[model samples]
Target: MSKWSGVLPRMAITQRSTLLLFALAWLGVCSSFTVIKDGASSLYFCKELDCPKFEEKYNSTAYQIRMYETSKWVSTTITGLDYQAATEEAFMKLFEYIEGENDQHVKIPMTVPVINRIQPGLGPVCASNFTVSFFVPFKFQSNTPKPTKKELFINTLGQEKVYVRVYHGFTNQTNFPKEAADLGDVLNSTQTYDKSYYYTAGYDSPFVSHDRHNEIWFIATDK
Candidate 1:
C-alpha cells in the first residue's frame, strides 16, 4: 500500500478542511479515483462541492478489485490472478499490510499525485516516470544539503520499504525549472536514468532537512 493512503484519519480536521477548501477553491486537488456501480472498466469522481453521491458501477470486476485494493481490503483468492484480477489481489494484500502502517514506516503527505495524469507522454514511451530517488540518513537534521543519488527498487514483491527523510519548504521560489533541466541534462548525459522526460525531486533537500520532508515529486504519464 502506498503510504499516502494511511494518513487521512490521523490528520487534523483543520488541515483536511483547509485542503477541502483548496480543492473546491483552487481546482488543484488531485481527483480521487473510485469504483462504479454495476459498470465496466471505468473510474469517476465528484468535481463539485455539491456532489450528490459517490456513483459507480458496482458490478464491474475491475471495480471490485479497485475497491478491495483502494479500500485496503484483501483476500488470498487474489493470488495467481493476472491482469485486472491480479491488480485487485495486489491491492488487497497491500491494503492489509497498510492496516498495520506505523508512523515509523509510512510517511504519507497531505497531497499525492497519481503521476500518470499530470505529465503525460513521458511514461511507457521511456521510463514509466523519471523519478530520481536518493536517500538522506536521519542524521541530516533540518538543514538541507547536496543529496547523493541512489537506485530505486521496484515493488515486485509488493513490499514498499522506502525510508524517506522528510522536510518542509515553500515552492515556486527556487529555480526549480533550471534545477530540473540541469538534472535532466546530467541524467541524460550519464544515462544513469533510463530517460529524461522526468527529473530528480531533490531540490528541497538542501533547504529542508532529513527529519522533515517537503518532497518534490514530478508526475510523468502517458496520454
Candidate 2:
C-alpha cells in the first residue's frame, strides 16, 4: 500500500476543530467547487485553511496530476544561501501584507500550503532565489490589497497542469531537494516538465506535530 493510505482517518480526527473553522469561514466562497459535498478537509491538504483549488487529472504510485485554476497570490522573494532562512523571511513579509500592512489596510484570511519556487544557483556556494507565496482567498482575488512594502506584490498564476509528489513532515532545504530529486527520477520517461525550476509546498502550521503534508510540483510542459 502507498504510505499515505489509511492516514486520513487519523488526520480527520485530529484536525476536526481546525477543519470545521475553515469550512465555516471559507466554504461559501468555494460553493461552485463541490467542497461541501466532497468534504473540503478530505479533498485538500490545507484542511485548516483555504487553498488554491485544483481538479485531479491522474494519479499513480509515483505521482499525481492536477490541473489548477488561475489564481492570485501574495508573494515576496528572498535570496540567500539557506532555503529555510529565505523562506521564513519572505513568508514574514507576505504575512505582514495579509495582516493589513497594505494600501487598503485590509486583514485577509490566511491560506494554506505556503509555496516556494526555487531557482537554484549556478555554483554550490552561490545563493539561490526563493519566492514564497500565500494563496489569495477567492473572495479577494479580483481586488487584492496592494502591499506597502516594495518587496511584496500580487502574482497571478494562470491555469496549468502540474505533476505532484506528496510527502510527509516538515519541508526544509535538505528534505525538499531530496524529495524533488527522487520524484524526478521516478517520473515516467515519456512525461515532459519544466526542469528549470520546481515548487515546494508546505501545508501545515509549525505547531501541528503530526500528519503534516508537503509536496513538490513540476509544471507539465506538454500540458
Candidate 3:
C-alpha cells in the first residue's frame, strides 16, 4: 500500500517455489504473468494488473531457478498465454493464487536453483526457450508419466518471443511415417547435424492449419 509497505523485506522465491507457482497459474488459466523491476539493482516491482512482465533485474539479482506446474486440465497441449496486463501485483496474485490452489501448504520442490529466467513462447507447444532466459529448462520426457513432483524452473533468460503455428492430426494418425522420413532427409542433408546438439521428438505447432491435432517439434538448446 505505502512505499514502506512496498519496499518491505518480502521479495524472493526458490526455484521449486517458482514451479509450484507456475502450476497454479497455468492450471487456473485466468490471465498472464509479468516480471518487472525498478532497475537492474532494484528488486522491487510494480506489476501491471493482469499479466506477466519481463524483469531483467530479477534475472541479474536472483541466484536460483523458479518453476511451477501448469495446472491447466487441457485435453491437449494446445494452450497459449492469452493475458492482458503485466504487473508485480498481478504476479503476487498469481503466486498467491497458486498457493491458494495448493491450499497454502508451501510444499515447494527441493531442486530450485538460485536466480531465474523465463521466456514464455506463445501457446500449445511443449519445448520452450527457458534457456533463452534465466528460467530453468523444463524437461518433459516424451510419453513418460508426469512426475509426482516435476521441477519448476526460474527465469534466467532475458528474452521473450511470441510465435504461432497450426496442427493437423493425432500423432500416429495420418501418414506420419512418410512425414518423419521427409524431415529426416532435411536434417541429415545439412552438413551433418551436430547430433549432440539436441534431442529429437514428435511435436505439433499451434497456429493455423487445415487439420486439428497435437503438433510436434524437434526441440534443440545448449547445456
Candidate 4:
C-alpha cells in the first residue's frame, strides 16, 4: 500500500477530512483555468526583447530602477510548502495545465523569473501563504485560456516602477529574508524607495549554477 493509504486510515475523522480537503484544493489549483476577458492582454518576460526594456543593468551595490509593464499571470497560493518546494510544485502544476491538462488544452511558453511573493499581513513569512506565479505569454494575453481546475486563477498586475537589487547564489528560507533585509537597509539609507511590499524574482532553473540571477524588487512609491 502507498504511504498515505496506511496513515490515512488511522487518522481521526477530522484529520482525515482536513487532509482530503487540502489534497482536493491542490488538485483544483493545479487543474483549473478560467477564460480570459476581452481586451485583456497577456504578457511575458522575454530576455531578448522585453527584459531589456524593463530592467536597466547597473554596477552598484545599492539598487537599479526598472519599469515594468502590466501583465497577466496564472498563479496559485500554497499554504504548507516552503519556498523551494512551493515553487517547484507550483511550476510543475502550471506546466501541466499549460500542456493540455486544463480545460483549454493550450500549450503556453514559459517565462523568466517565476515570481514568489509573501502574502501581506499573513502573520510571519515562513512556508505558508506563498504565491507562485507564471507569466502568460503576450500572444495569449488578449484572449487567455481558462484552467480546468478551480483553485487556480488569473490576475492582472498594473504597470509600475521599482527599485531592484540583484544577487547571485541559491535562495532559501534563511537567505531570502536576510538579503531582503539588507536591501531594505540600502533603500532606507537612500530614502528613495517605498518598502511597503517587495517582490522576489528568480531567473534560473534549479540546475543552473555559477552566474545565476535573482532579484529583490521594491516598488517605487515616491513617483
Q: Which predicted model would earn the best lDDT?
A: 2
Instruction: Report RMSD for candidate 3.
Output: 19.5
Ranking by TM-score: 2, 4, 3, 1
Better of 1 and 3 by TM-score: 3
lDDT of 1 by residue, 22-64 (tens): 3342232123212223221222211111111122222221111
Clashes of each: 17, 0, 59, 11
TM-score of each model, in listed order: 0.22, 0.80, 0.23, 0.70
lDDT, model 4: 0.65
- Higher-lDDT candidate of 2 and 3: 2
What RMSD does each model have against the real structure?
A: 22.3, 11.5, 19.5, 8.2
In candidate 1, residue 65 scores what lDDT?
8
In candidate 2, how many Å is residue 147 off? 0.6
Residue range 59-97, candidate 3, lDDT tens digits: 111121122223111011112232111211133332342
Best by TM-score: 2
**How much lDDT does candidate 2 score?**
0.79
TM-score of 3: 0.23
lDDT of 4 at 2: 88
How many pairs in model 1 have backbone atoms within 3 A of each other, for residues 3 or more apart or on separate chains, i.e. clashes?
Answer: 17
